[model samples]
Target: MTLETGAPENGPIMLDHDFFRDPHPVYREIKKNGNKPTEVILKTGMAYIPPGLKAWLVTSYEDIESVLRDPRFAKSIADAMPLFAANAPARQEGGGPGRSSLLYDNMANNDPPKHTRLRKPLNGIFTSRAVAPKRADIERAAAETLDAVAAAHRGRDGFDLVQDFAFPFSIAVICDTLGVPVQDRAAFNSWVQTITGAAGPEELARDAGRMAAYLRDLLRAKRTGTEDDVLSLLARSLDEDEAVAQAYALLAAGYETTANLIVTGFLTLEADPQQKRRLWSDPALVPGAVEEMLRHQSPFNLSLYRYVTETTVLNGVELPAGAIVFLAFAAANRDDRRFARPDEFAIEEPRREHLAFGGGIHNCIGKHLARLEAEVAFGMLIQRCPELSVLAPPAADAWKVSPTFRGLRNLRVGPVPGISETGRAHD
Candidate 1:
């Protein structure tokens, strides 16, 4: 379905199911309008904003980067809450606010110096240098997860990659990094799903509060515990609420996005068998391949809503004060101006700046760790499970329902001839 460029007479363009499953074509259509911003609305429950609310969708690399870097575009959730409150559709019974306070309180949703202050303690920890030491742990976790997947489905038709491998594996690593107890780890999947899913206000509130309480308890435990995880570090430095909020952001950010990256990365390889073969032939290309995966199919379709603090011109378009803007990273990464043959997934393509992890001060802090994890994930899959392939064509409802995030609901694979519990192909 073609995306209409101008403002619709009825309302903002309603994003259809096709748009969620495959957004590149829609993005291409939007970018065709001389790279101008278009007003659009996400499907109900698919966005952090109220569904059917009109928002500016910035499609071009130049415009998105400009918005990300410009202080005129505020990142604070408080700035955007009034807009949601005014424009939000009537909530169901017992639904007070559209979003929980826990979501709005974090560094990701705040402008500096609040954003600066909150991110300061985290800056040193997530850098490439600091994250390098965790490579061994990431690899071990990936291998173990793969082993379980192979063993469970050795003779079965197929097994879900997301449920059996990617989601659990990614959550395990993040939980370990955060020092969440093994018993408490199981609750995270349910908590994160409700918080991020297209759930009602009460469900969102309940999950957010539960996760917040869990983080608070974990932080309290870390005060006297001997663990050296991220939570322990935050426990010593920040107060209870501040630390819990940051921890919540970390958990939310580090969990689904990374898991989706792994699943999508494999999907990219499956689509381009030559690329998969190239990686298997030469493991050295894994890192660059991971970057290409990020660019070709970024895990996030758009950046979080940035409110216009004052009237400003972005990409020759005037956006009034309090206007809501969403930077379409998936769209910008596919802009032909920035990367030649942007639609194709090619590892050998020359390096270029892509907005996959976003840009500017509010950019993703866990980017280095994310890249490292993807590299390990792709490398291990190629080196060990060379015979692996997607079992059948992905189902019509394969993609997750979130408007902002892109990930598979489940990916089936296997019915291996000779796969061992070790996850190695035994011919």
Candidate 2:
């Protein structure tokens, strides 16, 4: 895979079966050899992007951090895409365009000034400082979901934890956090699924439109005012479209990633029984265990392409403005240069910092909430079901279909669920 010019060569490779089965090997290949501008083909069905786009990937840990922190890397998806720009208007002082959900100016799709506007007011709500009150909600959600799993399994050997437990648990927490009314939850859940679920670009765009419209209406209602919920606070701070985007971010960030973390963390523990037993023996290690799980199975394989906004060079590699680049978080997380046995899972791994939450300014907003959710969710699972085990060996197709997202499509667990000594669940 070396270049003929005695330099490294990168792709125009298709994100095919081998990639879906395991992208890590390709990530390693990119890490070892790729240093110049290269193209990774993305099909339209892969995501909301109308596809056929080329993305240059940066895989080294240092370079990943560099690009994420560098202000020159554009976050506006509209800026990276001309198709989006025709529909999306200028980034207004209050918000960017809401022409399409795919092109909507959410926090993930904006550089600073716009990003700061969308993110600033929501920070206090999503902070560790705010996690304590929701701790009870998160814990109850976890315990209750596990309880349902136990009830459904009855005398059975397994249940789909991904659907029955992890998915709704995260969705419920987000709904409660956003103060979406109990009556509106069904509609809310539909929108979340449409955004996060596997669907073609046309379907995703339609769903995104439906989601955007619903949120716009919801945001309008919130503008009349309430003391609670992130949306109401955002409505007061931002304009109509900006408020809707911020509200959308809450659902977008809160759902899929958190769900994947719970599922992935559980699967990781199941795979390494020795490590699982160690965590059970010393439950104080759960926090660190959560971190290790996050690093070991970073929910995202590649970051959204960061368009080079200016000519940039770092560590002797140069990229011109308008160049599309992606930070391979999964690759960087497992870089041997930075981590001790990069591929192995160990709770006490000394270097725990990872690009899982991304880095620098464009980092995830719901991260603290996500971490707390994982802690409560996985902690409840291990403490209650000490005998928890995956029913069937993981097959290749068990992984999610999306090239960027990595999560188990189905994680069936148990040899019959057990009640905790504290009465968290009963048969």
Candidate 3:
């Protein structure tokens, strides 16, 4: 297998460089054997692992979508990895808190009843209409972020879009939606950074607990009397534990995914300047372009850990009860069977079915919000900095390594010659 920094990964899938930087090639190799969504038992000497990465890796569009929609394909990370779940530090090392503090709380990775209960209260807020009013706000946030980047690089030619624009732009929208206290916003980034795979397990556990406590306290404060923000609405109904869960989900899900999308959208367009020109020429294509970006450049490589609820069969692959399976989102999006010229970037595809935000009941609740943010972000970006061009491929040496999430460490874009007149790039 080709790797980004180190020697080639000729073994099983671990956190290999080749897989992260341009995973399409690796994904094609997985399908080369013509046994997509193949069944295999991960063993030592074959797979190069960094620690507790043990699961049934699922690829192929049909199988991935099937698994995602299948009720038997469970999302219980605890039952799937019981040993790791019991060991808190090891679990944290693997990926933050386990069953007790996380699985039950995070609706994105849990099964029904509990999942239903957790997701019920805040569903209304994420719907398209509910999020419609925030379009102007998101646009403003994008513009403001671009403004800061412009100011910083006034004399200079370039800046890091991930640090200067993508992250800040996303965080701004989240802060507004959550009504995160002005004072709390500063500390908020520190807390989010800890969870973003920057801190070690011990630090992660401590930070997660601290952040949970902070959110719980914030919920309690809002419970007295509050407005229509999600937290305020949740505060009225949910207990501290429940409120903390919802708040954490909202905060984590809201910004990170959109931030990556923002970075990828710009980077992808930059890679293919002609496509960027087409998009810039046709403003109506912005929404469809966002869909294509989601399909082609999925931010999260795989879905959260899923356990087999019962005996299941997919394309002759027998999965025993309680077996672990990771639904491959990025791979499925590029499946040749599902997409025409699957690897190529097409702004306007005739058929585009992407699992970037997942599907079925456990699908991303904030997908509409994420889409809106991207629509405004790219639209504003093309308008705000027309001279913007990539210095190099936006791929980075350091990546946020998480089993569930994938994001660039930094994306350095150059040739930005200050903020341009909004209408100057009419070409």
lDDT of each: 0.78, 0.71, 0.70
User: At residue 183, what lDDT does model 2 achieve?
Assistant: 81
RMSD of candidate 2 to the truth, in angstroms, is 5.0
What tens digits encode model 3's per-residue C-alpha lDDT throughout 164-237? Answer: 88888888898898888667775777777666553555566667777877887788888986466778887887
Clash tally, candidates in order: 0, 0, 1
Clash list (residue pairs), candidate 2: none
The alpha-carbon lDDT assigned to residue 94 of candidate 3 equals 56
Candidate 2 Cα misplacement greater than 4 A, ranges: 1-11, 34-38, 44-47, 83-98, 225-227, 418-427
In model 3, state the lDDT of residue 214.
Answer: 86
Candidate with best lDDT: 1
Model 2 per-residue lDDT tens digits across residues 1-427: 3232212444365556566557787777666664333346543223344344555667778888777778887878556567333222332242222355542567887888878877888777777888768899888877776776766677877888788788878888888888777687667666666555456555566667777788878878888975567778877888887787778767766778888888888778888889888887777788888888888888876776577768777555666667667777877888887887898988866346888999888788778888888888878876777777888766887876665667777877776566444345243
Error of 1 at 281 (Å): 2.3
For each candidate in turn, the TM-score is: 0.92, 0.87, 0.86
